[model samples]
Target: MIEILNPTSLPQARETGALVADILQTMRSRSAVGTNLLDIDRWAKAMIAEAGAQSCYVDYAPSFGRGPFGHYICTAVNDAVLHGRPHDYALGDGDLLTLDLAVSKGGVAADAAISFIVGDFTPPESVALISATERALSAGIAAAGPGARIGDISHAIGTVLSEAGYRINTEFGGHGIGSTMHQDPHVSNTGRPGRGYKLRPGLLLALEPWVMADTDELVTDADGWTLRSATGCRTAHSEHTIAITEDGAEILTVAGRAQP
Candidate 1:
């Protein structure tokens, strides 16, 4: 379902977005070599509870995933890209980790994701992959505004990824997000411009641009949740939730570090 927040609820949306961004940033700081993925999940759980917020992931039973995600955050490592279920594994040096989080506070929800390298080892390829996704995400956000079409955002994102020589996957991309986590008006990573739903004020969208280094194919891990590259190539994903406004687009899920 597509949901547009009322002006009054927009404040709550900003609050929830800040909370989500802060939590993800804290988790990223705590993540390092030898840090267990389960520990990260536990940290997220504690933080969500402390903030009186609800996790949009844990207990989530979507058709694409096994029932009840049972994790506070998604810990996608190196080859893994989306829906990565937290496990007993510990992060290794130079491991590319993607943390995707969504939470509801004051009846409004925001979703965001970040990809970064763990420890002191940053491979050139990994750095490039992460940069490409971030650039694509920025492009998508720049293309979003009141009266703009969804395809315009998708096309901008696709242009960035394609130019960076990464393959785009449309099976799982960004979407409308509001009171609930995932909503309608599916936003693919790549699409033709001047097509699809026109943007309007109060509409919230989570624009994510993710890509695999080599192929567009994906293979699910044994856990039935984690989606990895079919060729086991490294992947990167970047996302943020934004609210369309009269002036343009207001980014709700800006990273805490980037905020004043």
Candidate 2:
């Protein structure tokens, strides 16, 4: 279902977006070597509860995943890319970690993700992967605005990843988000321009650009949720929720940036 927020609800959407961004930033700061993935989930749960917000993930039962995610946040490590279920594994030095989070507050929801190194050992390859995803995400956001098509955003994102020598995966990508975490108008990481749904004011979209270092194929882990690179190569993901407006796309989930 695609949802467009009313002007009155836009404030609530901004609040929800800020909450999600703040929580993700806090989690990233707390994450380090020896920090268990489960601990990160616990921190997210506590923060969400304290904010009087609802987790979009914990009880999520989507057809693509096992029923009831049962985790507050997704912790994708190293080769893991999407739907990363929190586990007992502790982060090691230089581990590339991705945290994806979504929450609802005041009847509005926003989703975002960030990828960063766990400790002081930042491998050059991991740094490059993370930078590529971030750049792709920026490109996608730049392509979004009223009258723009979803494919334009996807093409901009794909261009960055492809130029950076990373393989793109379309199985899971961005989507319209509002009262719910996932909605219609699926936004692939790569697509032809001038196609797909046209952007409109009051519409919220979660634009995520993720890539694997070597291959586009994915393999699910034994947990039945975590999606890893088929070749076990490292991966990175970057995302943000933005609201389309008359002027342009206003990114809602920004860590230290001003909200439009």
Candidate 3:
């Protein structure tokens, strides 16, 4: 179920991407030492509805996760990495928070994620973990372009994580996004270049690089969701939805300014 989007479809994707980015940004801003996770979920829901966009997470029933996620967004804190179900917990200073969001707008879907420290006291390890994922994400995006193989992107992403002394996990990585949140052409975080699917123009891919501080293994929380590091080490994740174009890849989920 690979989806390709032409130039026109890119705008709708930008809208979806912008909504995701803005929501994450807003949530991060509003989040405080005592802010409850449920409040964050509520904020996300309000923004999604206000944008007239549909949440890819709510009512999601993926096999790996508990049926019908029933959440507006993924609120991963500290050890929690992916599929974090919001619970009754208040954020604390220096807590590592990750927000992953996906939304469908005008029939196109865009997904993105961001990790940041909650308050002050940014631990060096936490900052390093977040920086490593961001660096890997940048490398992966840079390797993406027309005529490049999916392996190229994977290799670029893996190199950064490996160089930073982090183990690679292939169970989950980037994937195609359009018309729906997740699609075909699975992009692993580590692979050989010049192999796997050959990328081309009009293809949309969500490139995410995530890593745990010490282990490649993951444990699921009692809730049947919320993947966490096996050793309880800190974690970080970075992601963005990108569209392949004639000259190169266009990142639809950039936060600040538009790239030329």
Candidate 4:
């Protein structure tokens, strides 16, 4: 469902966004070589509980994924890109990890994701992948605002990835997110501007730009949740939740902000 949050509800959205951001930042700070993915999941669980917020993923049972995500956060590593279910594996040096998180608090929701290299071994390819996604995310955000169409955002994101020589996957992209985690008005990583849904005030959108180093194909992991690159090439994803306003778009999920 598409949800246009009211002005009063904006505070709750911001609060939820801040909480998600803090949890992600805390997790990122704590994650390192030898850190277990399951441990990260446990940390997410504890933080969410402490904040008195609900996890949007734990009970997520969608047609595409295995019923009930059964985890606190998504932990994608190296070749993995999306819906990465936390496992028992420990992180290694030079591992590219993507952490995607969403939470609900005060009856509102916000979602965001970040990709970074673990440990001191940062491969040039991995760094490039992460940088491309981040730049595309910024472009997407810059294209967003009241009166802007969803396609405009998509085009902006696509230009960056394509110019970076990465292949774009349209299957899973950004979407409208509010009281619920995923909603209508699917936003693709690449598209034609001046098409698709028009932006309006009070609308919340989670624009994510993800790409694979080589091929655009994806292969599902045995776990039934993690999505990986078909060629086993490294992948990266970056996301942010923004609220459309009269002046422009207000980013809701930037990390390192003082909690409200």
Quick one: best TM-score, which candidate? 4
Per-residue alpha-carbon lDDT of model 4 for 1-260, expressed as tens digits?
67888988987788888888899999999999999999999999999998889999999999989789999999999999999999999999999999999999888889999999999998999999999999999999999999999999999999999999987889999999988999998999999999999999999999999999999999998878899999999999999999999989999996655254
Candidate 3 local lDDT, residue 244:
91
Q: For candidate 2, what is the lDDT? A: 0.93
- Per-residue lDDT tens digits of candidate 2, residues 1-260? 77878888877888888989999999999998999999999999999999899999988999988789999999999999998999999999999999999999889889999999998998999999999999999999999999999999999999999999987888999999998899988999999999999999999999999999999999998888999999999999999999998899998996654233
In candidate 3 the C-alpha lDDT for residue 1 amounts to: 76
RMSD of each: 1.8, 1.9, 2.1, 1.0
Residue 133, candidate 1: Cα error in Å is 0.5
Q: Against the unseen true structure, what C-alpha lDDT does each candidate score?
A: 0.92, 0.93, 0.90, 0.93
lDDT of 3 by residue, 195-221 (tens): 988888889999999999999999999
Off by over 4 Å in 2: 256-260
Query: Of models 3 and 4, which has the larger TM-score?
Result: 4
Q: For candidate 1, lDDT tens digit of each residue in 1-260?
A: 77877888887888888888999999999998999999999999999999899999988998988779999999999999998999999999999999999998888889999999999989999999999999999999999999899999999999999999987889999999988899998999999999999999999999999999999999998888999999999999999999999889999986553222
Residue 247's lDDT in candidate 4: 88
Residue 61's lDDT in candidate 3: 94
